[model samples]
Target: MKNKLKEIFYAGLIILVALTLGLAPVTQKEIFSLKWKNLGLQLVEAGVIDQEKFENLYTARGGLSESDKEMLYGRNNRDFKITPENSGMALHMLWAFGLANKNPILEDGPMMDPRYGGAENFASTGGWTLAKGSTMDHYSMHSFVTLTDDEQALVEKVSKGIFRPCCKNSTFFPDCNHGMAMLGLLELMASQGATEDEMNQKAQEVNSLWFPQVEKKSAGCAA
Candidate 1:
């Protein structure tokens, strides 16, 4: 009887181990879906991002794939997925979106606080060099995704809670590129009617992709 019980326990343990191993890849393959259509093309046409400079920046780093190019220059009718491979590109594009999109958060939020000197002084604005003109020229200048008053409030509320590993400031401040990109993503998600829970979940997933090494270490500790 003792021997039989030991065999049953070991067999159960082996099955559990196999199940965990099998599910690990599926969990790691998580993707963030966004209602991205012509937003990328709009960014290019609006001079928020000079196509030549944007292409050159990626060309030196092994060029944009066909799917990436379509997202930038063509009408991507499908919902965009932020995969590990495209997360870096998504970061820059969303940075441009957040920087250029006309929103009260950028105009009246913490970025414009008198203590910061000016909005251009921060990396989120000054650090972007791909614009057709001075980065400030395109700063909060376009209405790519006009949010309702409620949606705007939702964005502000959620942005306050989402912070990147690189900085202590929340996305509401957007002093860095990561913060700005997050702000852009929040606005886009809110505009598309994403609930607060969805916003938080996608934000976490995107952050994991943006800072994979940090996430890996954090995951290791948790495990």
Candidate 2:
């Protein structure tokens, strides 16, 4: 009986190890890639992100790391990889891009719904204080990454399915920072000819990083 019990214990231990490995969270992998050549420079030049204010925000949060500085100020020809360490900066970068980029989603979509009292009233709009003027001044005002008609349709369709942990609304109705940042990401992906599956995959990866606490709870529950 003792030998039989030992065998069962070892078997259960092995099974537990395997399960733990299987459910390990993907926290360090490259979540998404952007051909981010001078896009950050463009945003600063357009005054959508005041360089001083932008830098100050990060300074208060332990200052921007050298890599973060490069992404925002340097003309990086290399594909920008989004990892957990820099996801916060990426969020703001994409938020600025999403907010400033002229797209029908911001101009004509649910953001403009008559019941919202105006697009400027939402956190996604009013919370962005880094702009040169009122956040509304840059709202959908720049043609940074213009999408073709078909591409725009893809963005619209995909945005409807993507929701942030901060809110229940889909990216189609970007009332908060996460939703707006995601909208920016989806637009960039679509403009670069990313397929629907690729967009969805990247979105999930990025969202996990953006909301790590929620992801941790989810992983724990699964394990």
Candidate 3:
């Protein structure tokens, strides 16, 4: 009876560990739908990317509208597709979103704290070079998306839970480049009315894209 009880306990422990570590089957199915057309236009309008740069960037990858030339002009499908080639572009757009979006989290969050030796010193603030002037010129100063009180709260709550592999800090802190980019993505999702669950799902997808080796190692651990 003692041996049997020990086996049962160990089995339960293994199952618990697997679940906690997200060892379940990963899927290729589209997890969430995002309106890229609107987001793209907004990014452009916010000076995240201009028409020439947008065209140049996307065209270099094989034209903005891969199929159905109509997508080139007006709104395309609501489903946001992720691919290896576009992953870097997505990061850039999200970085822009983080920089331009207006929210109290950027103003009052840990990024504003003095311990980081000033916000401009960090990657999120200093790493951005595509903009017209210094990245500080646009750091959390633009009004791309206006979030309501509740929406702002949602961003804050979601940001606290999301962590980046690049650093130990959560998006709320956003000291590094990846954390700041994630913060921007979270803010965009919240302002666009993404549910908490959806935000988490999208975050996982984005992070996986950003760090392929990390995802691979994680999967290997489960195996």
Best by TM-score: 1
Q: Write the per-residue lDDT of candidate 3 for residues 1-223, one digit (tens) a residue.
A: 9999999999999988998999956656653446656655655555555567557666777765553222233455465555565666567666777876766777788878888777788787777665655667677777767788998888788888777777767788877767777887777687688888888778777777777667533211121
Stretches off by above 4 angstroms in model 2 are 1-27, 215-223
Error of 2 at 189 (Å): 0.7
lDDT of each: 0.87, 0.86, 0.69
Q: Where does model 3 exceed 4 Å of error?
A: 1-28, 50-77, 216-223
TM-scores for candidates 1 onward, in order? 0.85, 0.84, 0.69
State, as a TM-score between 0 and 1, how close model 2 is to the true structure: 0.84
Q: Would you list the rank order by TM-score, best first?
A: 1, 2, 3
lDDT (tens digit, per residue) of candidate 1 on 1-223: 9999999999999888988888433455646877789999999999999999999999999999987887798786477788988888889989999999999989999999998799999999999999998999999999999999999999999888887777767888899999999999999999999998889888877888887766533211121
Local error of candidate 2 at 160, Å?
Answer: 0.5
CA displacement after TM-score superposition, residue 183 of candidate 1 (Å): 0.6
Task: Return model 3's CA RMSD, one decimal.
Answer: 10.6
> Clashing residue pairs in candidate 2, if any?
none
| lDDT, residue 193, model 2 | 91
Ranking by lDDT, best first? 1, 2, 3
